[model samples]
Target chain A: MAEFWMSEIIKECARQRISLAEYIIRGECENSGSTREQVIEKMGKMLDVMSSAANGGLEAPIRSNSGLTGGAAYQYHQYIGQGSSLLGTVMSSAVEMALSCSEVNAAMGRIVACPTAGSCGIVPAAVLSVGVSHQKSREDMVMALFVATGVGMVIGEHATLAGADGGCQAECGAAASMAAAAVVNLMGGSDEQALHGAAIALKNMLGLVCDPVCGLVEIPCIKRNAIGASTALVSADMALAGVQSYIPFDEVVTAMYAIGKQLPAELRETGRGGLAVTKTGLAMYETLFGTPMSL
Target chain B: MNATYMTGSYSVFDITGPIMVGPSSSHTAGAARLGKIARILAHNSVKKVTFQLFGSFAQTYKGHGTDKALLAGILGLNPWDLGLRDAFSLAEKQNVEYIFEPVTKPTQQGWENYHPNTVRFLITSENGEVFDIVGCSLGGGKVRIISLNGILVNFTGESPILVTRHYDGPGIIAAITSILYQDKVNIGNMRVDRKRHSTTADMYLELDSDVTERVVEEIQKIPGMLNVILLQRINEDQSLNNIE
Candidate 1:
C-alpha cells in the first residue's frame, strides 16, 4: 500500500531497456495475467471514457465560458478558446485518433482492437499531447509511456474503466484521467497533482453512459475524447493549483461502479436508453441509420 | 506468435527490414546491441560467437543484410553508422567469423519473459574465451540487450562505456576503473547492478573514455574475471551525425 512513485518507476525503467507496456505487462503476467486480458482491460477502460463523453459529461453542466454551439465543429471551437493551444491540438488529435483506428480497422492489421471502435482516440490523443506540448524526446516518450502504464495500472485497480461496468463515467472518464495524469507528469506535474488529476476526472464523470446514435462508436465517440481532454486539462490545472479531492481514489472508483450498475441497460452502451430513447434521438437515428432500428 | 508494438503518436517505428543496405535495422542496430550485450556477458571477452535466431531473422539474414550488422556489432559497430547497412556481407570487413543457427523450437518455459523473436548469440574468441547474449528488437528501431550469459543486463546506449561482470570481490571495480583511470578515461556515471542479493553480477560503466581491442584482451585475463565492455567510439567526422 505504498504510494507509487513516478520517479522510481522511471528510474527503474531507465536502468532497464524495456517499454512501459512490456515492463508492466511483464509484471502483470508474473502476477498471473494473460496478455490478451491485459490489453483488453486497457481497451475496455478507454472505451468507457469515449462512450461516456459521447453521452453528456459533467463539463456540459458546468458553466461554459463560450456560447459557440453550432455543430460538432463548435465543440472544437470551444476547446480553442480554453486558452492552451495544446488543448486545441489534443481535441483535433482526438478526431485524428478516431479516424486513424477507423483507417487501421479499414487497412492495417491490428495487434489488438480498441476498447470499442468509438473511443480509440483517447489514449493516443493523450499520448501525443505529451510529446507535442512537453517536447519529449523519443526516449522520454518511451519513459513517459512507462509512467503512463503505471498510472493506468493504478486506475484499473481503483476504478472500473469500462462502459459495461460503470458506463462512460468509468470508461472515458478513466481514460481521460489516465491521459491527464501522464501529460501532467511529462509536463512536470507532481505525483500528487497527477493522482489528483485522475481523482478529479473520475469525480466529474461519475455516472456517464454509452449511448451512440444508432449504436455506433463513430458518431459521438470521437468528439467525446476531445471534450474529455478539455476537462482533463482543467482538472489537472486545478489539482496542480492545490485543489485536492477529499475522496480517496479507490472510493471514487467504487462509487463509479455502483453508479454505473444503477444505470439501466439502455444506458450501458446498448444505445437503447437515454439519448437513443429520446424522440429527437430516435428521429436522428432513423434519419442517419434507418427506420425500424428496433426491428 | 505475438509481435507486440506500440508506436506513440508522431513517433516512427521502422520494423520493416531485409533491405539491400549493409546492415538491416534488425541486424545492424539490433545486432550491435546484441554484440555489445555479448561483450557484457562472459566478462566481456567474447572470444568466439555462435548465434541463434528464429524464423525471419534466420531466413533472410543474408538478403536482409543482417550480416553487416553482426559483423560490425561483433566488431562492435557504431549504432548510427551508414556503413552498418552492409554488416551482414561486410563482417569479413572486420575479420571475424560467425556461425548462425536457426532455433525451430518454441522458447522454453519462463523464457516467455524474453521476446519471442529473439537472437541468442553464444560468443567466444581466439583464446577460447566465451560470452552469451540475448537480444531483441522492440519496434520503433529500438533494441534491447536482455541478458548477458545468465545475468540480465539492460543496455540502452545511454552511456558510451560497456560493462563486465564476474565473481564480485575486491579489485573488480578497481581493476576496471584503474585501467580507465590509467588511460585517462573519464567515468560519466556507472550502472553497476547485482541480482539475487549480489552473487554473480554485471557493472555497466558509462565512460567519458573509450575502450580499445587491446584493453578488452588484457581485461580478459583477470582471475574470476568474466568480460570487459567492448565499446569503440567512431571518430567524430561523419556527415550522418549532422543530418537534418
Candidate 2:
C-alpha cells in the first residue's frame, strides 16, 4: 500500500505523458492485479448500469415504496420537453437525469452506487448529461467515470463517504465533487483544473446535514441529488474558465473531515433533527409506520 | 516523508459499484450480502430464518428495503437481481419461512456493544439443524461476519474461504496447512476459535484462490475432522452450489 495524493497523481501523469484517466487505469490494474482489458471491461459494465439507472424513471412515472418521492423526474422531463427550462438544455437535462436516477433508487431499481446508493444520482447525471449534450462517445464517458473514481478514492481515503459517518456533506457533497472533476476532464480541462473543480464543489457543500425524513432516502435525498448535479456542472464550468480555489483539494478534504466530526449525531442521518424532525416530517413518519417518531 | 493513502486493497470499482438494487447501500445491499454469506455458511440448507435487527437496522430496515434484501439473499438472490423486489413472495414459493425481530434493548447478557447496523440470523436447516450467526453491514455494501454459532470470528467474505469444525487436538492446524501447501493454495489469513475445555474447534482460512475438490476431499479425510465447507468469495459471481 502506498500513499495517494492528487498532486502526485498529476505529477505522475505529466511525467508519463498520459492523461489522468490513463494513469488511474494503470494504477487500478496494478492494484487489483487485473489486466487493462479486464479493468476497462468492468468500467464499461458500470457505465451500462449508470445509463440504465439514469433512464429508469424517465419513460414513465415511478413511485417510491414509501410513497414519499415519485414522478418528480418525469414531470421535470416533461417540462423540459415543452421547452420551458430556464437553465438551458445541458443543465436542465442534468437535473432531470439526476432526479431519474434517484427516483429509480428509491423504487429499488438496480443502480450503480457511485460512491453510495443514497447519492447515486449525482455522478451519472453530471457525466452522462454532459456527454450526451457534447456528443462524447461511450468510451469517453467511461474514461470520465475513471476520473470520478480517482476523486472519490481520495475522498474515501482522506475523509468519508457515508452519510451516517459524515452527514450529507460526505455523501452528496463527495458525489458532487467527484462529478465536478469528471466533468472537467470530459471538457478537456487540465488535471489541475479537475482537482480545482472538485475543491470548489466540495467547499460549497461543507456542513450540509443528512437529515433524511423518517430515515428514508426519498424526500431530501432525491432533491439534493438534483441540486448536486447542477452544482457539479457550475463548479466544472468555473474551473474550465480558469477559476481557482484558494485552498488546495487536499486541504478542502481535510476541512470537510473536521467539519464532519463537528456534526452531532442528530444531523448524521439519524432522523432526529434538522428537517427530519420537522412537524411535517414527523407527521409523515407517523402516517407511514403507524408509530410516533422516537429517538 | 509524505503520508500514503493507497491501501491497494480497494479497487476503484469498490468505491464505484457492486451494481445493486438500492435505496441505501448499507441497509439494502450490504444486508443482502450478509444474508447470502450466512446462507453459504449454512450450506444453503436454510428452511427458516429469523433476523434480529439492532440499532440502525431495526430503525430503518423497512424503509430501506433491508428486510426484502435480506430475504432475497437467503433465497439465493444476488443484490443486482431484479427478483429482489419480490423477495417476500419468492421466499413463500420456496417454503422458506422468515421472521423479523427488532431489538431495542439487549435480549440477553453480553448482547450490548454490537455495531449499529447489526443483525443476528437464527437459521433452521431442512435437516433440523439450528445455528445462529451475527453480522454487521459496514456501509457501502461492505459486511462482516462477526460470529458463527457462538464462536466469535471475523471475515469480510471478499475472498474464498474454508470453515472447518474439528476435534481440538494437536497437529490439526499443521495437517490443514500442509494440505493447502501441497495444493499450492495460498492462505491470505486464518483464525482458530475454541471454547476452553471443549472437544471441538472452528478454523477459518481465508484463501487467495479457490481450492480444488481434491484438496477439500483430502482435508475432509483427516482424522477427527467433523465437517469441511468451502465458500466462494461473495464479491464474485456466486451460485447456490458454490460449496463442496
Candidate 3:
C-alpha cells in the first residue's frame, strides 16, 4: 500500500502519467485489499446515498426534534422559484441541497456524513447539484468522489476531521476543500488545479469555530453547510480560471489544524461560547431543553 | 507539533459513515452499532440488559439519542432504521427490559484507560446466560469492543470476525489459521488477549471476507477451543438495511 503526501501524490501522477483518480484508486485498493471493481461499487453506493439524502431533505422538510432547524431548505428552494436571487440555478440549488442534508440530519433522518455529521452537506451538495446541472455521467460523478476522497485522505492523514479535536474548520473547512477539488476534477481540470482549488477553499475558512448552540448540530451548522458549498464552488471556479494559492493544499491543512488548536475550549463544540452563548441561543436552549444550570 | 493526522487505512465509506439516522454520529450511530453487535454476541434472546455509560456518553446521552440508539441496537435494529425513534416503546414490546446508569469511569475493577464514549453492557439472555461486554464509540459511527467479562479483547465491525475463547495453550491460533487457509478466507489481522499469559485467552481475527458454515464447524472442533463466534462485517450484517 502506498502512503502519499501532497508532493508525492503530485509526483506520482506526473511520473506514472496516470490521472489523480487512478493513483488514488490504486492506493485505496492496495491498502484496503479490495479490487478496483469493488472500490468502484462502494463509491457507487455512496453516490446513491448522497442523492437520496438531498432529495429526501427537500421533499419533506420536517422540523428537527430541537426545533432549531427545519423547513429552511424548502424556504430556500421556494425563494429560488421566485427568481429573486442573483445566484444562478446551479449555485442556488447547491446551497438548498446542502441545507437539505443538514436539516434531514437534524430531524433524525438518514444522511451521509462526508467527514463529520456536523458538516455532512458540503460535498454532496456541491457534487450532486453541479453534476446534475452539467449532466455529468454516473462514471464521471464516481470519478469525482475518488478525487474528493483522495483530497480527504490527505487531510485526514495530516490534520483532524473531528470538530472536537480541530474545531469547525477541521470538519466544515476540510469538507469544503474536499468538495472544491472534486468539482474541479468533475469539470476536467488538472490534478494541480484541483489541489489549488482545495487550498483556496481551505485558506478562506481558517480559524472557523465549532460552537453548535445547545450542543446540537443545528442552528448555525445548517447554514454553514450552505456557505461551505458556495465556498467550494467559488474556489473551484477560481482554480479553473488559473488563480493560484500562495500556500499549497497541505500547508493550508496544517495551518487549519494549528489554528483549531489555538481556538479556546469554549469555541470548540463545548456549547459554552460563540453563538451557543448568545442571548438568543440561550433562550432557544431554554425553550427546548429548559434553562441550563450554568446560565 | 508534528502536524500530522495519519491514523490507519480508511475506506471511502469511512469518510461517510454509512447512511444513518442521526443527530450525532458518535452518540447515536455509534451507540446503535454497539447495541447491535452485543445482541449478536449474546447468541440468544436478550431478556434484559443494562448500559453503564462513562464520561461524554453519560454527560449528553438523552439529548443526543444515545439512549434510544442503544436500545434500538439491542433489539436488532441498525443506525439507519427509522424505528430507532420508537426504540423505547419497542423494547417493551420485545420484552427486552433495559436500564441506563451513569458512571464517571470504567468501574470494572481492573480495566483502565477508558474512551470517553465507552459503555459497558450486562446482558442476560432468555436461557439465563449472562455476560459482560465493554465497547467504545470512536466517533463517526465506528466502535471497538474492548473487552468481554473482564477479559481483554478487540474487535471493530469493519470486516468479518472470528472470535474464539479457549484455554491458553499451544497451536490454537495455528489450528484456526490452517482452517481459514484451506477455506480460502484471507486473514486481515489478528489479536490475542489473555488474563494471564499461558492461561485462558481470547483470540480475535479479522477476515477479508465471510467464511462458510462448514469452515466455522471445523474450527469449532479444535481441541482447546471452548467457544467460537462468527461475526459478519457491518455492511454484510443483515441487521442494517440501506435507507435508499
Candidate 4:
C-alpha cells in the first residue's frame, strides 16, 4: 500500500502474512477510498463483460470492419473441442477465449483492457479459461484478478503499457505477465511464485515489437493475444512447479523498458517497419485505404 | 508522464480506460470523448462543426474511424454507442454541417503545444454562438480538454466536472462551494484559471457526485457568474455495485 514496486509488493505480502490478493485489496482500498466489497463487486462486473465478449464472439463471429479477423475464435474453439490440441483443456481453451476477446475488440464490441485494448484478451483468456476448467468460484476468480491487477499496476508504474511508447512488449507482453501471475495465484501458488511467473513471462517476451498491418488492431494483434495466453499458462505452470527466473520481476521490467526505449519508432506502433512494411502488408494497406502507404 | 500518473492515483477504471465499444482506444474512444466535451461546451446548440486533426490522428483518422468517433461524440454518443458506425450519415440527416480537415505536423508533438493525438473543434451554434476547443487524446481511451476558447484549462472526463465561466472577484469560489455544501455535494477537487489582469476566469470543479439541475441554477444566479455547464459524467458508476 505504501509503495508500488514489485519488491515492495512482495515484501508487504510477506510482512503482513497475507496473500498477494489480500495485499492488493488493502492497497486498493487505501488508494481509492473504496471498501473491499465495492472493489470486489466492480471486479465482478468486469468478469461479466469479459465473459459476454467471448460468448458473443463464439455465438456469431462478426468480421471486423477491416475484414482481417473474424471466426478465428470460434474456429479455435471448434478445433480444441476436437481433442487435437496437446495443450489440454486449460491452455487450449485459454487460446480460444483469447481469440474471442481480440476478435470482439476488432469488431468494436465491448471489452475490458487488462492493460490496453490491443492486448485485452490475454488476462481474460487465461483467468476465465482456468476458472471455467476448474469451476472456480467468482470470489476466488476475483481474488486472482486482484493479484493480476497488482502485477499490472507495478509494470505500469515501472515501465509502460502503450504500444506507441514501448511496442507490443508493453501491450501483449505486460498482459501476459499479469495473466501468468494470476494463473499462479489461482492455482494456489505462493505470492513469490506468482511474481516469478510474471518475471519469466516478461523475460521471454522482451523486445517484441508492435507491427499491426495497415495500422489496424488486427493481423498480428489478434493472434498474438492467443500466443500471449498460452505463454502465460506455460510460465505459470513452471513457477507453480518450483521454477525460478534468473532476473527478478522488477529487473525484468527494467530490462523491458530499456529495450523498448531502444526500439526503432517504426517498430513501436508506427506501422512503418517490421511486418508492417512487408510487401503483402503494404498491398493490404492500399486495398483498404485506396491509397499507397508512403512507407 | 505527468505528476498525477506518477503518483499512482489512477483508479482501476484507468487500467484499460473504460469498458466500451472499441477498436483502438486512443483513436476511437478518446476522439469520441473529446467530441462529447465540445458538445457540452457548445451547450448542444452546435449548428456547424469543423474538426482539425493533427499528428497521428491526421494520418490515420479514417482507418481508426476517428472522424466518425468524434462526430458521433458531438452528436452526444459515447464510445459504447453502436450507432457510432453511422455517425456520419446521422449528422447529415440531423442537418448538422460538419467538415473534417487533416493538418500535417512535422512531429506527433506539434510545433507548439499540440500533443500527439490532438484535435481542434470550431463549433458554431444556430444562435451565432461560437465555441472553439482544443483537446488531446492521451491514449488508452483517455482524453484531456486542454483549452476552451483559447483559455488554458485542463479537464479529464473522469468525474462529474462542472465548468464555469465567471468574472474574477472575491467570494466567487466561496459562493460555489457554499451552494455545493448546502446540497451535501462534496468537491473532490477544483482548479481556477484566469487571464492575466482580467476579470474573466474559468473554474473547473470535479464533484464527488452528480449535481442537481437546481444546483447549477443557483450557481448561475450568483453575481459575476457568466455561464455554468456540467460536463456530464461519461463512465458509469463502477465505484459502487448493487450486487451484495
> Which has the greatest lDDT?
2
Worst 10 residues of 2 chain A by lDDT: A1-10
**lDDT tens digits by residue: candidate 4, B90-131:** 998989999998887453434225688899999998899999
User: Can you give the TM-score per candidate against the true fold?
Assistant: 0.41, 0.94, 0.88, 0.87
TM-score, first chain, each model? 0.65, 0.97, 0.96, 0.97
Query: Following a full C-alpha superposition, what root-mean-square deviation does model 4 have from the true structure?
Result: 4.4
lDDT of 1 at A79: 53
Q: For candidate 1, lDDT tens digit of each residue in B1-244?
A: 4323322121111101111111123433456555554554444454456778765455445433354455556655554444454555665654567787767666662333476346788777657866666777543234767666565655554335566877878777778777667777787777767787766668876666555777767667767777666645433223222422
* Candidate 3 lDDT score at position B155: 75
Question: How would you encode candidate 4's per-residue C-alpha lDDT over A1-295 as one tens digit per residue?
Answer: 3556878766666766777788777766767778888878778887888787766677666798567668998887777778888888888888888998998888877788778888989999999999999998888888888888878887888899988889999999999999999999898898899999999999889999999898888889999999999999999999999999988999999899999999989999999988888999999889888899996
Residue B115 of model 1 has an lDDT of: 62
What is the CAPRI rating of model 2's predicted complex? medium
Give per-residue lDDT, candidate 2, residue B88.
96
Residues forming the 10-long window of minimal summed lDDT in candidate 1 chain A: A61-70
True contacts kept of each: 0.00, 0.67, 0.47, 0.43
lDDT of 1 by residue, A1-295 (tens): 2233333444444556654445554554444334645433443333333332222222232111111111343343355556544634645544444333322221111211222223334545555554665666544444444444455455444455446456777556766666666566656666556667767876887777877555444335545755666566667767778788788555676787788879887777566777666786677666654454573
Candidate 1 TM-score, true structure as reference = 0.41
Best by TM-score: 2
In terms of DockQ, which candidate is strongest? 2
I-RMSD for candidate 4: 3.9
- Which 10 consecutive positions of candidate 3 chain A have the poorest summed lDDT? A1-10
After superposing candidate 3 on the true structure, give the runs of residues whose Cα lies further than 4 Å from its correct spot: A1-3, A290-295, B1-8, B104-113, B159-243
